[model samples]
Target: MSMYVRVKRQDQTVFLRAEASDTFRTVKVALGDILSLVLDDIKLYGKDKETVLEDEGTLGGFEIGNDDVIFWGQRMDGSTFEPASGN
Candidate 1:
């Protein structure tokens, strides 16, 4: 089963076809491919915008499902953040 989700980085957001049963680690891998960054180098955020998503576990565990939004950036954890760049 696949879900379409919104993912943003810097000034752009892309709609991605994500496998629903995949782990957050899988999302990292796909984002790595899309954003040209290594898996370890990417950072992810959810709706709260304060929690850094480091979970290697499944997206279902995070309560994320279809049509969710995941914000991504190159900024390291603890670095200064601007408001997520896209809607």
Candidate 2:
């Protein structure tokens, strides 16, 4: 089934239509396409903003549901950077 997910990077947000079976890498590629960034530079976080979603993991495996928020940030120098808080 298809579901919507809210992907956020600081104050910027994008809603992506995805399927439970879709891999996190797929989501990253889509986000990269929209943001004009390299897919390898994108990193996705869970709702808690702590857990790093694995590229091979599926949305359903992460328990991501419709309207769920996914935090994203750019990877720099092989280090993960946290996205600025929207608040």
Best candidate according to TM-score: 2
What is the per-residue lDDT of model 2 for residues 1-87, given as tens digits with 9 covering 90 to 100?
789999988888999999999999999999999989998888888888878898999999989999998888787567766553442
* Model 1 lDDT-worst window of ten: 78-87
- Report model 1's TM-score to 2 decimal places: 0.76
The alpha-carbon lDDT assigned to residue 36 of candidate 1 equals: 85
lDDT of each: 0.72, 0.87
- Give the per-residue lDDT of model 1 (tens digit) for 8-86: 7667886778776777677878878876877766667876665677757666777778899888767556565445445
Residue 81 C-alpha lDDT in model 1:
46
Candidate 2, position 10, lDDT: 84
Q: Which 10 consecutive residues of model 2 have the lowest summed lDDT? A: 78-87
TM-score of each: 0.76, 0.89
